[model samples]
Target: MKIGLYFGSFNPIHIGHLVIANHLVEHSDLDQIWFVVTPHNPFKKKSSLLDNYQRLEMVYRATKDYPKLQPSDIEFNLPQPNYTINTLVYLQEKHPDYKFSLIMGEDNLKSFHKWKNYELILENHHIYVYPRLSKGHVETQFDNHKKIHHIDAPIMELSSTFIRSAIKAGKNIQPMLPQHVWEYLDEMNFYK
Candidate 1:
């Protein structure tokens, strides 16, 4: 099966995430999208992230209805400062039968060069980059890569950082997150 790996911290899953996953499955030839919940993204700030299990559960709640969108806890067992190249290597070794591709935003594509073994990832796997704020920049730079694809994914300004701040200020996050995810966060007093 062809799997598109949508790796993120998922500090709390939201509608924007579901929209992109749906777009990828519906528009692309990918069989499914696995939400690889990262324990600690090398480029992101660790201070704001919730526990890996909690983040994974939120992703589960958000994507429960979509069979094509499944949550994966693969990185939870790996070492800290989760690197995409290592994770990809591990996944390839374990699931040799399945073809793995990357589903990342255009913003990330701009900084892809800084990632460890970036060339290996580009050579071995397909990268589906959804358009983001930095559209022109990302597209221009990615023109050199044959394995890269550009897709039209809605650019919602909503972010996990914004949601976390809202929750900390006792604001409602219903507009940003799925109802099931909101309920889960409420029950656990998450982001508080």
Candidate 2:
């Protein structure tokens, strides 16, 4: 099986995420997409993040109906400030028969060289880049690389930060999130 590891903070999984995942499964060679929820992204601020379990649950609720999509807490068991290279290596060892690819946005690809052992990741795994609005057109050194593929998936300007801010401001965010996720957030009084 070819699995695409779509890593994110998923402070609250939203529609943009769903759209991207669905698009990848339908249009790419990926057999499945695992939403690898990062417990602590080195690039992000830990103080602004919700609990790992909460974020994982919201992802689960949002993607439960899609068999091709799964919510994974793989990084939670790994070290703090999880690095992509380590996770990929561990996954390869545990699931030797399954091939894994990295799925990310073009904005992330623009700064991917700064990631730990990024060159090793590029050499070993396939990378699928999806477009994100307002990031501007970024041309990478590896644009012509065979292992790296740029996909024309639908772009959404929506972000978890925007959703959280809307909720905190007492604004309606039902349209931004999955129905079940919105209900879960309301029931738990999250992000308010």
Candidate 3:
């Protein structure tokens, strides 16, 4: 089976995340997509992040109805300061029969070279990139472009930052997030 690892700090899983997962499953050859909720992303700041377990629960709630999309807290068990290479290696070892690839937005693709062991990752796995504002920049730099498949998935303007800000401003973030995720965040009074 081929699994696409949609790695992210799902502070509170939103509809945007679900849209990408659904698109990948429906349009691509991928068999499943695992929302690998990271405790800490090396490239991102930690101050804005919610608790890993809480974030994982939000992802779980968001993806519960989709059998092809799963919420995985795999990085939580790994060492702190989770790196994609480390997670990939561990996952490869654990599930020897299944193949894994990366599913990321074009914005992330631009700075992907700076990631730890990025060359090895590019060499070993296929990267499914969705078109964002940074697509042109990434396409220009990458010489071996065949490894990257640019997908025309729904472009979502909604982000975790927007969600957080909405909650902080006492605005309605219910529409920004999945129904169950919104319920969970409201119940916990998260981001307040």
Candidate 4:
């Protein structure tokens, strides 16, 4: 099986996430898309993130209906300050038959060189890149890298940050979220 690992905090899973994952899975050869919910991202602040289980629950709610999309808590058990290389290695070890690729934004690709053992990662797995409205430049080497593919997926500017802020400000962020995720957040009174 060809699985695309779409890693994120999913502080709350929103529509933008679905659209991109759906588009990629449906358009590409990937058989499934896994939303690898990170327990801790070295680049982001831990305090701002919700509990791991809560975030995972939201992901479950958002992706339940989509058979092609599934949520994974693989990072939850791994050592904190999670790194992509470690997860990739662990996954490869467990699922030898599965061809796993990365699903990341073009902005992340720009900083791909800075990741741990990035060279090794590039050697082993393919990376599917989506467009993002961020400012930065991709390294010249990655521009034509065979393992890195830049797909013309829709540019979804809606962010979990924006949704969280809106909910805190008592704004209606329902439309931005999957119905069940919104209901889950509302029922739990999260981000308020």
Candidate 5:
């Protein structure tokens, strides 16, 4: 099976994430999309992030109804400060028959070259890029790269940071999250 690894912190899974994953599976050739919930993101601060298992629970709730979209906590057991390359390598070893690819936004593609062993990753796996409302140019090297594919998915401006802040301020961000995910966060009183 061809799996698209959509890695993220998923502090609390939201509708925007589901939309992207659903769109990709339905529109693209990918067979499934695994939401690889990272324990810690190298570019993000860990202070505002929720517990790894808690965040994973939210993801599980959000994607329960979608068979094509599944939640993954594969990075939790890996060493801290882990990179995409390490995850890719580990996944390949465990499931050599499955073709794994990356699912990222254009914003991430802009700085992808700086990622650890990016060249190696490009050489081994395909990267599916979605649109995002962000500034800066992608490196010319990746513009027409055969291994990189720009998918015309929805440009999701919604972010976990914005949702977290809204909840803390007593705002009704219910519609922004999946029904089950919203209920879970509300019951746990997270970010508030």
Candidate 6:
């Protein structure tokens, strides 16, 4: 089975995240997309993040109806400050039958070199790069690499930060989040 690993903190799952996952599943060769909820992103601050289990639950609520989109809590049991390379290695060892690829935004590709063992990731797995809101193009050294592919997925400017801010201000964020996720957020009074 060919699986695409879409890694993120998903502090709260939003429609933008869903759109990208759906787009990739429908348009790309990937059979399924696993939303790997990172316990702690090495590049992001942990203080602002919700509990790993809480974030994972939100992901489950948001993607419950989507057959191709699945939430993974694999990072929760792994070491803190989750590194993509380590997770990929572990996943390969555990699920050797599955062929895994990475799904990332062009913006992340710009900083790809800074990731731990990035070269190893490129050597072992393919990367599907979706466009994002950015002023300039990503200048990657692997532009012509066979393992890297540029996909024409829609670019959504909506972010978890914007959603959190809206919730704090008591603004209507219904359009930005999945229905179940919004209901869950409202019931839990998250980010308030």
Q: What TM-score does prediction 2 earn?
A: 0.94
Candidate with more favorable, higher lDDT: 2 or 3? 2
Residues 1-192, candidate 2: write the lDDT tens digits: 999999998999999999999999899999999999988555666676888899999999999999999999888889776689999999999999999999999888888889999989989999999988764676878788889999999988898999988999999989999998999999999989
lDDT of each: 0.87, 0.91, 0.87, 0.91, 0.91, 0.91
Per-prediction TM-score, please?
0.91, 0.94, 0.92, 0.94, 0.94, 0.94
| Residue pairs in clash, model 3 | none
Residue by residue across 54-143, what tens digits does model 4's lDDT show? 999999999999999999999988987778999999999999999999999987887788999999999999999998876665465699
Off by over 4 Å in 2: 41-47
Off by over 4 Å in 4: 41-45, 134-139
What is the total number of backbone clashes in candidate 3? 0
For candidate 6, the lDDT comes to 0.91
In candidate 5, clashing pairs total 0
Task: In model 5, state the lDDT of residue 134.
Answer: 58
lDDT over C-alpha atoms for residue 135 of model 4: 61
Estimate the TM-score for candidate 5: 0.94
Tell me which residue pairs clash in candidate 6. Answer: none
Worst 10 residues of 6 by lDDT: 39-48
Clashes in each model (backbone N, CA, C under 3 Å)?
0, 0, 0, 0, 0, 0
In candidate 4, list every pair of residues with a backbone clash: none
lDDT of 3 by residue, 45-123 (tens): 7777887788888989999999999999888889877689999999999999998999998888878889999989988
Looking at candidate 2, what is the lDDT of residue 125?
A: 99
Worst 10 residues of 3 by lDDT: 134-143
Q: Write the per-residue lDDT of candidate 1 for residues 100-168, one digit (tens) a residue.
A: 999988778878888899989998999998877653563456676789988877876678888999999
Candidate 5 local distance difference test against the native: 0.91
